[model samples]
Target: MRPYLFLFLLGIVLFFATCRKKDTTPTPSTPVVPGCTSLLAPANGGFVTTTSVTLSWNAVSTASSYDVYLGTTPSPTTLVGNAVSGTTHTVSIPATPNVTYYWYVVPRNTTGPASGCASGARSFTYIVISMPVSLGYHVVGYFPSYRSLADVPDIKFRMTNVVVYAFYQVNSAGSLLAPGSATAPLAAVATKARSNNAKILLGINDGSGDGKTNFKNMAASPQGRTNFIRDIMNVVRTNQLDGVDMDWEFPTTSDGTDVTFTSLMQELADSLHRDGRYYLSCAITAGKYAGGIRDAIRNELFPIVDFFNIMAYDDFSTTTPYRHHSDYALASLCLNYWINTRGMPAAKAVLGIPAYGRPSGITQSNTVLSYRNILSQGGNAQLDSAIVSAGTFTNYTIYYNGQYTVKRKAKLSKDIAAGVMFWEKWQDATDGQSLLKAACDTVGRSY
Candidate 1:
């Protein structure tokens, strides 16, 4: 009995010692952060022109938090937010026009940086966001379909005037065809314009063909011209389009094509005005060298079309050898030529501003760069300020209009022209530095 008791006591003592000893074996290490998938927003190569942007991503399985990097740099180093517990982040950046930003998610676990999920990077360019105010002036914004259909809420109340470009394009055969990829939200655009008391028009341009030849051929006889008119009316009625904008590039050349173009304009204006609700406008050549657009302004085009949109950028063709393309000097010279020299009515002129850029040595049409592209590639906004002050930036030869330049152009338009028109809204910065917004802020500020 004593031996059995001793054995039991020894077993009890061993059990107590085992329980008291610290367990040194480590528990499983924290799991690594899983790779992120399904990125959204800005739609990959998406561009925006606005004051604020929202960034979003899908959830990572093992991530406890996320780190967002955003900046103009290709690899953004600016930490937008660190250890963000959620998946969405909204950033309110400067309104500096034509800026592009790169961003990505670095999802992490509790462990450390090495445990972060390697999500890839994405980019978005800020184009013009909104035109804040209009002073009863014609602020014609050409909304291009190269990008997404811009939500009309962004500009309807402010710009109050938009052209959904481009509905029909002229083929080499001199036939009018639907500009399939370039047409934007027509119904929505009409709805917004009606609601905001804005005027929305549809644009027709010479597309990918000999526009001069097409115009000449179509106008040589009444059949081709009448068919074109018929199509225009059909589209205008079906879409509830308030008007039509004829973008016949360089129809007023020294060639006889100018005569035919004039006739086409006459017929189009007559047909559209027959309804009274439809207005007929045209985009024509600038006064001098607007790059490839050297078509001399003719005194004849004025009475036919309701207004003229001068293609105002790409002044690099000046013999002075100055690097500036869309500078104050060129705009001044063009305005003088159109209104003062050509004897165009100030009420019928719409100053045209380019939303694209021509880098040094790029002269061809394909060589053009959108303002967003220039900004995405580190265009100098500081230089833009110099340009606004009637100065020039010599460091780089890239040609574009910034926030300041755009505003000044608008003021100039207000002084001499009845309205201001842009080649495109897509090309302007979608946010704070937007050229269109600059025009809106400057044109009506005094009023």
Candidate 2:
């Protein structure tokens, strides 16, 4: 009995000792971040022709509100707007024309004190143009099949007083057109524009590549170019188009090719300007050289062309970790690069954005995934990627690592460019709160 008592006592003593030891293992903690998903609007710097330019953004989920700042410098950032709620807010700029102003937004919540959300600082140039005026057109090709254009108020909103609104493009390359056709859609677009009391800028841009593209040779060869122009002219005559927008995917970098391309543009600009019946426009690259070509056009063809829209999106991959296309800063940099660095006029510089987004995790092996399919089960992990359209590729591969998927929201705000352009109107969100519409709203312009 004594031995059993001794053993029981020893066991009790050991348990007490174990319980008395202090635990040293660390507990998991939440990430110490000022805010999450605080964004800059206009994704690309947008056009402004007013004493005031609006700045807006999607609100941070954990943020109770936001603080807006503006200054010529990044540090000692001057406060402009404060305590803005909802997902978006607008800030006004009363600066003079062509002045670059920097801005940022901060998030505040109960979990954290009011802290700087300090987004990637963005900037834009301002000009004094007419009030509530912007220059652009919505060219929808994937419509009715993708979404209805009538449901898009952004298209009809600013378009009310504006001259041009929408153009239903008949793709000469893809399913948009049969072997040789443009008249049907051309007539349809014209009728709709007339009904809306607006002008339809005909889209003659062919996106088809080397093979299986009828317009490929047309853009590259002299005879083909001539014939293509004739076809476009015929459509203009038949539909009474207000103007023609030649969207040749790209031009030749070959020797003497530059001269030919310049000559072609000059002739088109000259002929169209002389007609006195219509306007001429071209969609050019968003790079530095675009400014050079635009200068040439202005010198030789500005008399005929109404404007040259710089297609600014599609710079980076949406699937990659780096933010692509509509990067707020990248857009600003491009605008500064072109206008300040390369020397292009702000009035003629219409910036382009994409209403569409590229799938990041979608690969060759497994391709189909909607916005729903890509979200994480817990919603804690977001497949972060930049939102922008690719320059000339159907799709790219994203490596499967922890179920990371990214999609682009190519909207614009901030201080940026003159106007905005989306690749196609049909790709706009169902609610009309799409990339292009967002840009329009930010700039206080409609549609």
Candidate 3:
């Protein structure tokens, strides 16, 4: 072989090798495409409730902007939720409860989405409920609006439902008075609640002032029932209320009361339904017969109510030897009566627990005690399961639910009842230590 020819070929080979090396090591300033977009916030399999969901991602070094996509299917086909110039953007979408959605992001350069920047989609449900698969349980809390709406903001986040208490008076002419202690405008309360994905309920109490006899008169006649129903519908619609919680304590006390009560309930439910999905609930005595509920229930009037809240607490009777007023056994008895004897749907039965406990051996009947008072009385908050019902019982007279018992009851509700409810929200401890927090967490953990 000619030396000059071999050297020429070797030079050509070396030149080609050098060109390949330069091709492999591209210039840094040339700007490579943005990396794949990574989703943040709603993480993977997260849940959202509001119509507006804030989506965020780590901004790619070369990305000048981003385009988001969302839809009901697993692989979203919609586009351009926002032209996010930064790492985050809150996208507005019509979110429905108990519905799941899919979303993804695309990092883009000035030219368009950089090469290989299409991201994997993630899914999230609009609701964060942990109710059982077979059954749906609601966590209902009573917020006495008269107390103060300060807790509304925080309580709304921790609850699935809220009831504003004391729509106090129902006059004899079948008139509806604006119940007392509204402290804050009912509309504001309703708006704040809906914003947090929680339900707002209006509770009517008929035991005080003209609330008693006047209510009895209003409840005794057909005209009274009709007039009251019209008035209630007005109030509910005017305030954009989620529902009405009837607290007619003794609708069955009089022989004729049952007839009017049943008719009133049926008509009210029909009216609310006609207006679109409005809920109606009740605060009734645990006693089936003595409480005047057996007749009301036997008449099949309860079909109108979304659920019946059995006031399982206040076991205090005419006589007492320091009995467990809110005993687990007593609650069970009440639950069994509604579920077993009366043939009530477990989904429509809500077991009510008192936030406060009674005084040990307070020989007086109907002497009320609040959970806050019990705590102030040096009641050691311990979860005791020794009783027939699993709950936290501290002090001989105090039978309130601690975090453990509350969680247990929440779990039990999934099986035996529609859900467990508290008399009031203000009575529990605060932060994660609060009973409300415990109840919410338990539902999250189980569901």
Per-residue lDDT over 1-447 for candidate 2, one digit per residue giving the tens place of the 0 to 100 score: 999999999999999998997988999765444564545564446545555556777656667777777776644378776666765656566656556677777776655644544556776656443212233433222212233445544354333222232333334532223224333344554465567665566655444543214434444566655655566666667667666666655554433344555666655554454325566667766664443333433344433356666676555443454344444455566667666765565555565554433344333223322222222112112332322223343334222111111112123212333455555444444343333444444445544
lDDT of 1: 0.69
**Candidate 3: tens digits of C-alpha lDDT, residues 14-116:** 9998778444675556446576778887877966757788888777888888888887887777885556788777777664565777888887775567544
The RMSD of every model to the true structure, in order and in angstroms, is 26.2, 29.3, 22.5
| TM per prediction | 0.61, 0.49, 0.61
Angstrom error of the Cα, residue 119, model 3: value is 67
The better candidate by lDDT, 2 or 3, is 3
Quote model 1's TM-score: 0.61
Off by over 4 Å in 3: 1-135, 151-157, 207-212, 288-293, 317-319, 363-369, 383-399, 445-447
**Two-way lDDT contest, 1 vs 2, winner:** 1
Residue pairs in collision within model 3 = 130-447, 356-371
Range of the 10 consecutive residues with the lowest summed lDDT in candidate 1: 385-394
Q: Model 1, residue 225: displacement in angstroms?
A: 1.1
Worst window of 10 by summed lDDT in candidate 2: 400-409
Error of 2 at 162 (Å): 7.9
Ranking the candidates on TM-score from highest down gives: 3, 1, 2
